[model samples]
Target: MGNNLWKDTWLMTVRNIKTTLRNPFSFIPNLIISAFFLLVYEGGLSGISQLPTFEGANYLAFILPVSIVSAAIGGAGGAGQSIVKDIENGFFSRLLLTPASRLAIVLGPIIAGMLQLVVQTLLIIGIAFLLGLEVVTGFGGILFVLLIAVGWGLAFAGYSAGVALRTGNAQAAQAGTFIFFPLIFLSTTFVPYDLIEAQWLKIAATINPTTYIFESMRTALIDGWVFWDLMQGVFAILIVCTITITFAAVSAKKAVSRG
Candidate 1:
């Protein structure tokens, strides 16, 4: 049974990846938006680095991780949107009739989406480097940044997938991802937590999981390895994943029964 699950997952994952590749329109927007944010923010907010607290800091490097992390979180909508299409066109119902393990079928697209997100993150990072952004931790930081991106991507993909499975509405699935947009901006997107003078926003940023993840990647890019900060990011990812994955699993089961 375990071997069959693995085989089913691999086949489904391959199919989903192939489908995504065949239809470039599905993911091109994500890449474009990520790159656009990186360029716009790096250009517009570059002066933020001139502040006393940011002395000698390169704003592009400081904000590079923001683009990577945002891509992971926002890029997940593609998975949900794809699933909604499957549900709409009756593909999901047909797949449910197969002998494939339900768990494997549910996991396949999420994993495929995560792999896509990782690639996007790498591409964005490469662009940043081309734009003169430098990582203090050098090449090793890329690995760490990828790890964090994967965690967040997987979590959000699962959450998005859950919404798709439950609603079977493309717009709802896509709109569900938007609910997180505020989380992105409410955090330390513009400035560091300590430097954020707005008391209310600072309070929100303190409790925001995005802040920890951002700081973790920032540490890798600008401050070198900080074991504590990285671990905090990992813990935050795990917590979010725990909620999102459980939601996905339950939604998958419900979807199967409804079909």
Candidate 2:
């Protein structure tokens, strides 16, 4: 029975992908925007590593995780916006009438959104490597990065989608993007946590999950693979995924039942 549900989910996922690709303009802009930011960040950070805290690490290597996190968060918010669009066009209601399981309907948009994230992540990593970022942990480290990226993307998407379902308005759904930006920027992604002067920002960085994600990626890519660090990141990912997915599922069910 579970396998059947997942099979149905995959079919729904494929349909969602087709619907998304039908609007190339809607999807391509995000890739372009992410690429632009990747360039600016890598270029800006390349010259800043002479600072004592960098300790001779390649600036591109240092910033790669930041770019990944940005892309995932952006992609998740984009996914929520797409859900709003579907609601506006009555596509979601149409899906509700179909035999597809509720989980399938909920995960379909998420799967499509993850595909976009994967593309952005690959493009960013390629560009970073071109700028001389080296993966010290080799293939395994690269795999770890990809796993974290996917986990973060899914977790954020679930949270954003839950909010969209509850609000049932595109403009309100967009608040997730605004909320995510400060969280991303205030973390240790751009600057080392220890270097932060403001007590508040320092305290926030210590608590922000993005900091752990960046630290995990940095350790995987540059500092050699450490089991405990990877485990911490994995644990965080699982917790976020569980909470957000539960919220999304509940919200989606409520929305469907109300209709």
Per lDDT, the best of the predicted structures is: 1
Q: Count the backbone clashes (under 3 Å) in each candidate.
A: 0, 0
Name the 10 consecutive residues with the lowest summed lDDT in model 2: 26-35
lDDT of 2 by residue, 89-207 (tens): 89888977777687777777888888878877888888777877788898889888988988989989999899888777888887666877766777886667776779999888878
Model 1 TM-score? Answer: 0.95
Off by over 4 Å in 1: 1-3
Weakest ten-residue segment in model 1 by summed lDDT: 69-78
Which regions in candidate 2 have their CA more than 4 angstroms from the true location? 1-4
The lDDT values for all models are: 0.85, 0.80
